[model samples]
Target: MSFNPKDALDAVRDIATNAVEKASDIVENAADIIRGDIKGGTSAIVANSIDIATHAVDRTKEVFTGEDDDED
Candidate 1:
């Protein structure tokens, strides 16, 4: 059998194209998962910060109004 250069090149090209496409899909999926995780983490941080701020404000108010003096 004679080797056809054009057919060999076409086969290589097809294989390379498929590999690149699969790699791109994997990268896209990974990026999506990372984005979701970051969003969830940010939301949790915001909620915790708000809770901490509220507690701080309540404590400050108590201190300023002499309510904390009773404990001392």
Candidate 2:
């Protein structure tokens, strides 16, 4: 298959967006951690962990497909 530069750029864009999301999550979580919103040995920790993973996945899909949760 011929290499398509547009597809390559789109893939890179998705990856970049994912990185940005992760960075934002880190900052937000750090604050939550300090504020005790993300305490250890609690469901808050588990829920936050799941949220981090789900957001990364959802962000990737949105970047690649141009559709968001609102459209679903």
Q: List lDDT for all candidates, in order.
A: 0.55, 0.63
Clash counts for the predictions, in order:
0, 0
lDDT of 2: 0.63
Candidate 1 regions with alpha-carbon error over 4 angstroms: 35-72
Task: List candidate 2 stretches off by more than 4 Å.
Answer: 37-72
lDDT string for model 2 (1-72, tens) is: 455567657756776676676667666767777877665424544555676567667765665666678675
Q: How close is candidate 1 to the true structure, as a TM-score?
A: 0.40
lDDT of 1 by residue, 1-72 (tens): 455566556545655565565556555555655778666555555554565555555454454453543477
**Candidate closest to the true structure, highest lDDT:** 2
